[model samples]
Target: MLDPDRIRVVAPHFKRRLSGVTSTVVQLIPAQRRRGLGIATLGPGLPETMPALSFAQLPALWKKPKGAAHRVWHARRNVEMLAGIVLRDLLRMPLKLLFTSAAQRHHSRYTRWLISKMDAVVATSARSGSFLKVPHTVILHGIDTDLFHPPEGVDDTIAGTSLPGEHLIGCFGRVRHQKGTDLFVKAMIELLPRYPSWTAIVSGRVTAEHKGFADGLKADIARAGLSERIVFLGEVDDIKPWYRRLTLYVAPSRNEGFGLTPLEAMASETAVVASDAGAYREQIAEGMTGAVVAAGEYEPLRDAIEAYLADPGRAHLHAKAAVAHVRADFALAGEAAALEGVYSRLLGVPATSPQS
Candidate 1:
């Protein structure tokens, strides 16, 4: 054991193993293909090398409480079996807790309750951490630079649509309710006229809840008569070129567990102009890396965008600086080493050298 301390790791069920395996291949499949700001810097494996566990075949369900109780019983037994598969890890693994999604208010509460049974906890972002009363460590997620790095070159074919003076700004991520696309779209409408040539791009799949919100954005864009200035690229397999063509990255999420999209943008060398979500507290260095407007405040975001548009040299400097900061503070190897240390500490035994 590396640390010899009391520990436990509870891996939450996200998707079926098959689906999980498919996830890597379908998108950002490996180190070379990582995307969305922060890449391998956040976890142990590249998209390709991530550990894939076999799913337990679903047994037939029973109708009565007895049947449901039986299911619960097996689930616990299955959990123990999983613990066994992890071997001593079950004993030494840190109670390192992390939850996902932002809009699900109960998720944080329930996760905290579940983790209360353990010795320690970890939060991927501040918003989640804020919900926890437990003593916890925060390990900001990292991004895979190899995959999400800026494209070899940038050719702004869309530049022709930009206002005579404004810069091209873009945002990307899952189109979901709490992501604050409404705020961003509204801000763009307000800001578009200030910088006539400036255009904003919102890309990704908007979820059902946000579908209406996304439509509102389209309507607003049309009303502003900036149809040519604003574009929704939807989801794309590659965002690397987007990074190189953009002057800034915007993440206007109403809530974020860790704001993975910002990390992706950072990894892609696009300095952020994001909402002051709890997660941004750890990543953005205010004026250095990018502006952190008050959470979901369109005015500040627009102001920041304007400031950057007016000074491309300044924006470029921040862009390079943000990337350098990520490389230094949140690189994949560093993240892996930190996680390994936690794991080793949880294992409670020293890792021996190969020859020894």
Candidate 2:
């Protein structure tokens, strides 16, 4: 049984499938809890540790918490936005509506309409704000530095898998055409033969629709007789060790909302070579932490990888800088505190004390 009366903030996630938005909610709620915020989720596909409010608990919003004004309903999806509107307007629930936008492209008319109903909006990055019809506060995404930190000492083997390589260049995320997985593969094919010391790894899930695309890349790797040099480890439960084991991490997505892989790699003290998609350019300090290349271009990515492989000393230095950069600038607690401010303002409550 949930004590809905204690809920001060409601983060609704109506979508059943796990996606980037879902991942953010999972990572965020725990951090928000650490700040002593009375927030909870209301949806499927979320971890059990996070507090959740049921449909029966919906009526509890009408009974405001002692001394507080109104509860807040934060939505991340169009459907979730609609639900918030219905509860506040149609059902006459006493709740303030909030929405966070992360799409980098123009939204559909329905989406725009849903956003128009929001009391306030949050954009994941400044680039994403350009596509928003309404003004939004830009709150960049952050990774869990504690979970994805540098290894005690560098290791050759990836902990979860048997994939062995002297140096691993990783391309992580969904394995699909849009993600520029092919570009990463092409770059690897052209350069791996020359740099016999380094191997490339693609670690991600290939959805049913993109299984053929993933298979095609494997075929190309085989045709080049470099199949052994390029490995596809599918999806793993633990990704920290993979990032920790990598000499360099590549994010070749053609487009992104606010790519977090580079930050994850940086947090793990690994040098990165990422396509200028989403917030990659802003996240990376060129020549200091990592290098950002033109999206969808294979030559630039190839050259970046080659340069890193040739002079690994430079890569090691950048990796150290990346770890420092992430710890200082991209802490998850910072994002959670920023969000808490937004929620507190909407509820007419004092801002929570900033977390470290």
Candidate 3:
């Protein structure tokens, strides 16, 4: 637990379910703490080991921290933004509210009103920033390279299950229409038979609403006799190892909010083929690190993935470049330092260099 009095910033995760926002909070808090930022999380669904303050401890916000004039209440969702308002406005707490927006669409009137109350705003991507009427800083999302790095050796087999083929291609996210799962399946069905040594894997949850959609895709795979060649491994606890096993990773989302899977895959030393959705185009270097196709377009996506599958050596070369790209530009440490600078400005404190 972080000492309540020492906390200069509070990051709240109001939602209990694991989501992109929750994942960001989980990955970012520790990195911020490593930078000597007096930050702590509040609410459920986070690891117990993380520095956290209980709801009962909300009263502590009435007092200022050791060095800062006011505590920064950093929010990523509407509910969290509301909570910050309640704490700062209703209860008269010494807090400066900050909100980070990742949605690429225009904000509703209610949402715009909430954003207007923020002391500072951060947009996760330039596309996301364009939707904001208020001035904001653009801070692209980064991943923990240490957690998602190249494998020690070449290993294709996934322990506990029989996933054959010398090389593996993967698309990981929710198995729904928005994620373009069917497009990946269609591409695999057409290409996997031609390339006998390669297999395709789809790893993500199939929600109750998307069960029919998932069932239909499976039926198509069964009809094509590619059930063995193309597999679905629902949701797994640790996705890092899966990234390490992949030769190429694809993010075929028809829509997204600053997608991080491509960055995760690149850090795992795997090349990517992603749709021009979210911040994918900004992350991928076209022919260098990977390829980006028109969002929801079937032919272009298929052709891009085929290009990687056709030349294994080319894929390996691209994967090496991707690893270097992510390390140089998207390390978690860089994000932590950038966010710390934002927090410093909000708290009226001088920014300090992050500890190595």
Candidate 4:
């Protein structure tokens, strides 16, 4: 538990279900704490190990923390933004509200009204920022290179599953149409027979609403006699190691909110073939690190993946370059430092030097 008096910033995760916002909060809080920022999480769903302020501590926000005029309330979701508004406006708390937007589409009028109340705004990417009607700063998300690095030895098999094939290709995330899982499956069906050495892995949850869609994909795989070659891991707890097992990682999402899979795969020393969705094009260096084709285009996606599958040496070269690119531009530490700057400005305090 964090002392309410010591907390200079509060990150609230209201949603009980695990999501991208929740994941971001879980990864970022520790990095910010390492920089000596007096930040803590509020609400449920977050790991108990995280520095957190209880609901009982909500009253403490009425008073300012030591050496700061006001506490920064950083909200990533709309409900969290509403909570900040209630506390700062209706209840009269000493808080400066901040909201980070990741949505790439036009906002609803209600959402825009809520955003207008924020003291500061952050967009996860330039495209995300363009959708905002208010002033905002763009801060791209980064990955933890130490956690997602290349494997030490030549171990191809995944720990628990006896999945075959020397070269593994992966597409991870929700098994829904929006994620373009079908495109990956269709492409695999066409290419897997030609390249006997390669296998495809699809890992992610299939919700009740999308169970039929998932079943349909499986049936198609069965019909093609490629069920064994195309495997669905179905949402593993630890995905970092899975990234390390792949020769190629594909993010074929038809739409996204600043996707991070490409960076995760690249950080794990695996080359990527991604659709031009989210911030993938910004992250991947076309021919050097990975290839980015038009989103939702089947033929182009198939051809791009074939290029990497056809030439192993080129893929290996790109994988090597990817590690360097992510470390130089998208390390988690850099994001922590950048966000600390945002918090500092909102709190009207000088940004503290990151603790060594």
Candidate 5:
């Protein structure tokens, strides 16, 4: 919950829980307006799941694409949902586009096109810029450092050694194709016997056809004789402790904008071994924060994991460096302030009040 004077952004599930972030900025900007902030959002469709668009903005829409023309087209259609948002909200001055390109294939092109026309772009990741074809100020999605801080004397409490502790290489997010859990399972079969203590815990659920993927994943794990080693903890609401518990964090995705999972693990002081996704390059130095290997190559993937397992001293050094490195650059309060600066620039107002 936020304080009375703060601005609120009602985000749906995919957008991170912004409560911790929005609240912090309210304290920093002392002269902020009493009315707080006015938000311009990507439309959340309409009530009754029937598209309802405002009458005034209907004319501003471009001709419907051949596919959606039947469903959202004008003339016979009472309200053109996509058009209404473009004309009504965007195309107005001073817009802050808080969008997710991850679902661009599903969103109306007119809406996506309109964002490229925004006064300024604040993308959560580097991919946002590429998707929009705009030079975006990478805000590097905010994390509540308080919730994800490194534990004290963490090295002492950590039981995992190359051989001493349980050999658990955990994947923190959902088990889906994009995540490449199938590949991880294959790699585990090749490596688990060499390190008996190793376990692969894949958390989160699958839907519809992807449910088949989960079943196949389990079957693979069982076939490899590592079923005892492969544990699935589905849909965890809190993932911080899971980071601390793991010997290393694995991100095998073919794509990532600014994979926050690695950064979060770094903050928890977990040594990370991730795909060389765009953002990972910015955060994890090869032998520093953690190592980054080419995405989707099984042999290299196995080597990176084996390298870490074989050398606890290097992993420990990288883990400690990762926590310290992220804390310096990825601080949430600092990011909120930078976001505030972007907002201030749009309003032709300086960040600090004009001499009160």
Candidate 6:
């Protein structure tokens, strides 16, 4: 239970499943609160770590804070946007509606119509901004550098697992076709045989619908006689440390809404080889931080991984540069500060002591 009077921002998430949007809310709200912003999430599926409001507590929005202008309701989904419009426009609540757009392609007519009614809009990336029909601010997502960083020693193992390998390469996300899991597996099967020192890992959930797809990959690994070297670690409880254990990280997705795995990898001091899917191209710097291959093309992906395996010294240099790149540009606090400015402007008050 939270004091309705103290709340200045309400962020709503409708989906129960863990997704890119859900990940953003889970990571951002805590950072926002740490910066002294009075914000709370209003929805299901969020972890206990996030500050949240109950449906019963929402009536507090009917009455604005004593001196504050109005409460800002930030929505990330079309359904949530419509809910905000109905609450503020139709129900006469003193709420300002702001929607954050993450879709990279054209929006549906219905989604565009809903966006048109927002008081303000935020795009997750410049590419996503191009698809938005409304005037918006571009705010890229940031990772918690503290939570995901390089390990202290050289022999780092993925905690809570018996998996062992000298060098671990990984592809993490949903185990489905759209994520290009098949492509990653194909590349690993071809490369792992020659490089006995390195192994590959695929970590993510396989929905009941995608069970066949997951099973096929496992069968392929067995047929290639590299089943022991190529492991499938289902969804992990703590993924940050897993990144620290990796020598090379791969993001071979066919589509994404500004994927964060590459950023997470770079922050962990692991070099990456990602496809030109989602915001991955924006995250990596060719030979500096990591390499990028064309989306859906496994041949180039294979070549990139092979190059990294052949030259571990060069890859280590890139990994060190990656750590510096992420620290300089993508801190979670920076994202929280930028968002505070948005809320401050909407409410006509100081969000915080001006960020540096």
* Candidate lDDT values, in order: 0.55, 0.87, 0.91, 0.92, 0.56, 0.89
Write candidate 2's Cα lDDT for 153-189 as tens digits.
5353454345545677899999998899999999899
Candidate 5, 105: how far from true, in Å?
11
Worst 10 residues of 1 by lDDT: 67-76
Which is superior by lDDT, 2 or 4? 4
Clashes of 3: 0
- Put the candidates in lDDT order, highest first: 4, 3, 6, 2, 5, 1
Residue runs of model 1 more than 4 Å from their true location after superposition = 1-13, 16-50, 56-109, 125-130, 155-166, 351-356
Candidate 5 structure quality by residue, lDDT tens digits, 1-356: 22211222212221222322222232323222322332112223322222223334333233321222111111101122233335436543122333323221223566556554444555555554556565556666545567776655544233522223454577866567877787777777787778775666777656566888999988887877777677777878767767776667888776654557887788887889888664676667678878788877778877888887777667778888988787888866555566656655544444533232
lDDT of 6: 0.89
What residue pairs are clashing in model 6?
none
Worst 10 residues of 4 by lDDT: 152-161
Could you tell me which 10 consecutive residues in candidate 2 have the lowest summed lDDT? 154-163
Q: What is residue 282's positional error in candidate 6, in angstroms?
A: 1.2
Give the count of colliding residue pairs in each prediction. 27, 0, 0, 0, 3, 0
Clashes of 1: 27
Deviation from native of the Cα of residue 172 in model 6, angstroms: 0.7
Q: Report the lDDT tens digits of candidate 4 across residue range 92-124.
A: 999999999999899999999999999999999
Q: What is the per-residue lDDT of model 3 for residues 255-327, given as tens digits with 9 covering 90 to 100?
A: 9988899999999989999999988998998899899999999999999999989998888999999999999
Q: Per-residue lDDT for 269-335 in model 1, tens only? A: 7778888664776788788888888776777777887787667778778888888888787665454
Best by lDDT: 4
Report the C-alpha lDDT of model 6 over 19-137, residue by residue, as the tens digit.
Answer: 99998888888888888778899999999867899998877789997569799999999889999999999899999999998888899999999999999999988889999988999
Candidate 3 deviant stretches above 4 angstroms = 154-161
lDDT: the better of candidates 1 and 3: 3
- Once model 4 is optimally superposed onto the true structure by TM-score, how far is the C-alpha of residue 68 displaced, in angstroms? 0.2
TM-score: the better of candidates 2 and 5: 2
- For candidate 6, give the lDDT of residue 63: 96
Which has the greatest TM-score? 4
The candidate 5 region of ten consecutive residues with least summed lDDT is 69-78
